[model samples]
Target: MNAPAIDARKWMPYPSAGGAPTTLYCLPHAGAGASTYLPWRKELQPDVDVVPLQPPGREMRMRDEPFENLTPLLNDLLAAMDGVWQEPFALFGHSLGALVAFELARRLSAGEGPRPAHLIVSGRRAPQHPSRLPWIRMADDPMLLEIVRRLGGTPDEILDDEQMRQTVLTLMRADLGVDQTYRYRPDPPLDVPITVLSGSTDSHVTMAELEPWAECGSAGVDIRLVPGGHFFVVTQRETVLRRVRHCLVGSP
Candidate 1:
């Protein structure tokens, strides 16, 4: 199959130092830019390409209106990937991005696009589980910030700036809306394997919440619990990346 061309400006592809045979698409959490995963470029082995999805209203597409409705936004993402997916690849998503990856995987499995070799879903609960958190994204800035502070992800300095805070808040709200408004449409279990990871202490998703992810695929689901809270991927990055590398390469 011919490789689909990916527009460089739309999606950030961190090529391995050497020509890698596989690609790992990294989806960022709500309100984040592609650059959030830029550091992973240096963290992983050169043989694994890391591509971060960049939605509109941030980074290179700053002027473009952000996606409020998840359907069209997800379809657009599937289109972009279909255009450039010619090699073996896997997907890793955190928080809201986890849902995006799940939905995208569903789309790919339904269409001509390629299904991921392995799926790594971190932080977010399984799709079958209903979210219990209030609509914090719609809350006032002070209240929203309070919720975000507890969950952890955005930096303290960025939260301190009024201008940046509002800008980021808008993006975050839209991103969260994607999660809040989502209604799961059940599909058959995917043939691809899945590796589920979560923080041992994360209040956002309990072990029960994470279990449904296993039902999403036919392959045996391997679950890994790391130390820390929701954003443990930051405090425990090397550990996270090591697992990601394992999923991508099928070896530790």
Candidate 2:
């Protein structure tokens, strides 16, 4: 069966020349679009094809409602990725995207399909570990604003505007619901190697919280520390890109 076509607006493709053995499929954090990785494509070597996966309900798919659960989201993504599983591919996801990548990898490995060569998870704790904070099920307007403030990813201009805030808040609530409802089911470590990235000052996730990612994979796991808070990728782009490139092409 042919794979379903992904919403073009959601996914940003970075094609590469031949002889590049690996393709890196990047998944964005909640409330973000594929453009988040636009800079990485230019910074990385020519051989790696950096294809950023854009989830629905954002950017060009702004008209579509955001997903509120993991199962449906992963199922749709797996379908979209159907025909493009030929080469050695790796999965990279940040925060919420990290959880999706790990779960998707599990689904792919269980099915009669090729698995990603590596899983690069950033800014998220391991699945087996429960979140440190209690779930925020229903946030009032003020609370929502505070949550967004603490996260520090949403733009202040958008959050301040009534119309923009409404649109973003709708998506944010749905994304948070998905995150809150998520219950990690433990399983044996994967054969693929996993790399975890964490920020030294990220209050949401700590070095200890990120270390358990080593148990998620059998081959081995490596952790890299960047110098910033939760949104380290934005502040330390060069350092993050350097680490990613090294992992993708450096001596094994």
Candidate 3:
């Protein structure tokens, strides 16, 4: 018999509030999971419902294998998030998530799905720029741990346990692999507005690297420099949410 089909609904475990005017689909950074955006619900609710996309191999989907390439992951997400395209929605992603959001927006613009109202990307260089970080799978375990340490959003429990540490490293390798191997294909400019959020002190992504987002969006790109390093999506949460709210709901 054929194996049971994977239920994509599990990718969006959080139920919508029903009162929101629009939905914001948030994707997480490397080594992180959907739960990273869970707190955003309280702040964006009643106007913008926050939907966190949980990729395989982390949190609730821990037993499933993560994608080691961007193509397959994007293909899976396009299929998994089919319902989201039918509504008024926007996309937000940080670091590895940024590439995912950008590609998804591109696919939607190509008529694979309905276009998102806006695309907000954080903590990553524009796709045309070469990645600054080395491929994690090629690095030794200690080096991988050091790289994760410098990025700084990982929880201590996973880092402390030997087995858990190895598991997380595998996940991170798969996540970074998606980033390190991505190739940007030139496409017609997207009609959607793009918002690029950069950390002022983020060594990983320079302002120069963030500026090219303007070329991708025909509607225009808004670049905001927030205070923090790499993980500003977490370090400066309120500021990011305020801007996101302003974009989607006309709120402060």
Candidate 4:
């Protein structure tokens, strides 16, 4: 039978019919929620149990305050993860979520906590990549909005609706704050296999930035280039599904 669901306050499984032999924990991009990975169920079902980690302050927990720092955030994430850490599991993260997954993996690799069998990171550069700016969260409204718009980070539909526009901006700023404030230090490479995925046309991340991720893990890295921009996880879902399936199949 599927492990009983975590507090539902944190991790939400797609279809809730879990009890699969393996679990895939999906982390979301900035300003996104668990629902963002809902489609993953159709692509990875029967063989893999797909669960999305939901932090406070977004979607169903809209009333909660967003995270401005990473330490406390990671602590909270780990606490909520206690239940599902059982069995063979993998982690898949995109963009901001990728960084979170990497750091979490580092901690898990240290010991005590459960380490994932595989880590699939997409649309993000390696942790050691030098930072270009102090903090995008500190950018002025017009400047920040312009960057998000130019990068297609925020949808136009959300921008069109005043209420949603404000909400999106608010949550995005906090999420970006989490990213901006994060500082990566050198850590021993994880023993788990890593898969680095990126969009062919994603200007924010280049192939050079992705290759370094291979050095962060000892189990070897497989780089896959999907055809799309920054949001390839959405636009190239099938490619991601196939790649993840291939990774899981090859896992021990």
Backbone clashes in each candidate structure, one number apiece? 1, 0, 0, 1
TM-score of each model, in listed order: 0.90, 0.90, 0.94, 0.91
| Candidate with better lDDT, 1 vs 2 | 1
lDDT of 3 at 109: 81
- Decide which is better by TM-score, 1 or 3: 3
Give the C-alpha lDDT of model 3: 0.86
Candidate 1 Cα errors over 4 Å, as ranges:
1-8, 13-18, 136-138
Best by lDDT: 3
TM-score of 3: 0.94
Q: For candidate 2, lDDT tens digit of each residue in 33-78?
A: 7888877776664756777887888877788778899998887777
Instruction: TM-score winner between 3 and 4, please give it.
Output: 3
lDDT of 3 by residue, 203-252 (tens): 88887888888888889888899999988888899999999999887877
> 46-110, model 4: which lDDT tens digit per residue?
77778888877798879878888877877777766665474688888999899888888887777
Screening candidate 2 with a backbone cut-off below 3 angstroms (N, C-alpha, C), the clashing residue pairs are none
- The CA-based lDDT of model 2 is what? 0.79
In candidate 2, position 6 carries an lDDT of 71
lDDT of 4: 0.80
